[model samples]
Target: MFKLRGRLEKHGEIFEIGQSVKSPILAVLPSLATKFYSNVPTPYEIVDAQEDRKTYQGTIDNVNRQVSEGKQGRIFAVVHVAGKQFKITEGDVFVIEGYWPPDAGDRISLDKVLLVGASDFTLIGRPLVQKGLVRVEATVIEKTLSHTKTHFRKKRRKQYMRINFYRIPQTMLRVNRIEIVGEVNHPPDVTGLETRIF
Candidate 1:
């Protein structure tokens, strides 16, 4: 004789099966199937949400304190300017090639910051950092033309030759300072230009 032993559920109540059968069965049937299955989390996989939040808050506080005290050390930033990106620090001079409209002695603030770092922490942007977070100030020190380059082409059999020389305009920029002007994780309020003229 064979007996089937398993648990059955009906009307939110569980009832045991094969209890009254006196004959011994060669094999026992497993419990009823479940709709879904999930693995139990191990010790290493379990995370305490409160503790994680506390640690994150502590790190933000530390960075804020460092910024407040001005002890964060020399900061550096990667800024996008005039279709190019430049990794700049305070007092660094760099050149931009092309026709840029900014004239010499013009002070400009680079708004398209990609990354900013200090001695302790770094902030990276997805496409760009939050506006007003990192301020990179620079001045147009000089505007001049790059060294001339010759473009020559010749066809020996056809007796055709062409020679051209040209120079590209360049703008020299001196980074005045790079600083964190806004609190970490805090973004400025959004405003629209509804009432202003172009």
Candidate 2:
């Protein structure tokens, strides 16, 4: 057993050392920021956020105008799928290279949204946007194999030669639509408060 030179002093020193160790680890892990800072914007984030401390709702009048006018053809979202990201809009068709999980003709909801942009505003996620906030509904149009690719290798001054053929499975998706359901700052009520407004 070690002798304590006053319990408070020893505990305080240990606590300080523990905090010093955790500070570095916390800094390295971005996921811990929300717990430590309540998701407060960093200096770099503040600068990136239009160099203003205020949220992207730059003007109340502008928001009102956009609300009144309604969202049009400018709606689009950056969706993450099968280790790749694609910037997609409604009615746009894009092919997902390599093996994909969904079946052909299956309607799947893309929840890993990196960013959602409109004509007036942009909502960017830290790593991924919150699920259900920006809904990206897509349909698996077709699942097929890519064009035949031949891998050829030859050694100079040697008789070693090898050829390999591959046809990667590809998934074609049609973005059904992107719907920004609610405000970023506030979550819509269960009773359908958003429906009441324009």
Candidate 3:
């Protein structure tokens, strides 16, 4: 009778304890997880894409009367592509988004240049792409070594060696000319003054 009483008491105590103990996961855990994910920003949002288009409108300085000289050579321009900064070298090959050439792989000359600006002067043309100022054409010059990987195994131990190299294809460009189809407002008239100072 005593054993039976003890067993009954122990069973009752276990039931009470079980009811008092809380679950491993609290009710609020799910909410906290949801909140954490909701607050994080996606990788695509790191750079604001809308702002890149606005950069098109800006002052262009045509240094050394680059517009009038008609001397054709490689020119450097800072352009943004897909939320990234790109230095466009003259005679480089690049295709426009909407415009397509008859030859798929053939070099398409940029006839409608938007603006021409150098260190000295800036010439703004119509919305049309400048015929003479578009990117020049160059073929892939050479492909250099890009990367290398090596692995060695000795005495049950593994060793890894990795080398990385990046190469960009270069093109040869012969500048024909640069011409602005539209007009320039408040045209800069100063010519013979000190080219060094404003």
Mind sharing the TM-score for model 3? 0.26
Ranking by TM-score: 1, 2, 3
Q: TM-scores of all models?
A: 0.72, 0.61, 0.26
lDDT of 1 at 93: 98
lDDT of 3 by residue, 121-185 (tens): 55444553333334533333332332343454445345655555444333222333333333334
lDDT of 2: 0.73
- The better-scoring model by lDDT among 2 and 3 is 2
Q: Candidate 2 — which residues are off by over 4 angstroms?
A: 1-69, 187-198
Candidate 1 local distance difference test against the native: 0.83
Error of model 1, residue 185, in angstroms? 0.7
The deviation in Å at residue 53 for candidate 3 is 24
Instruction: Point out where model 3 deviates above 4 Å.
Output: 1-66, 69-74, 80-84, 90-116, 122-133, 149-198
lDDT of 3 at 113: 44
Expressed as tens digits, the lDDT of each residue in 70-101 for candidate 1 is 99999999989889899999999999999999
Give the C-alpha miss distance for residue 55 in model 3, angstroms: 22
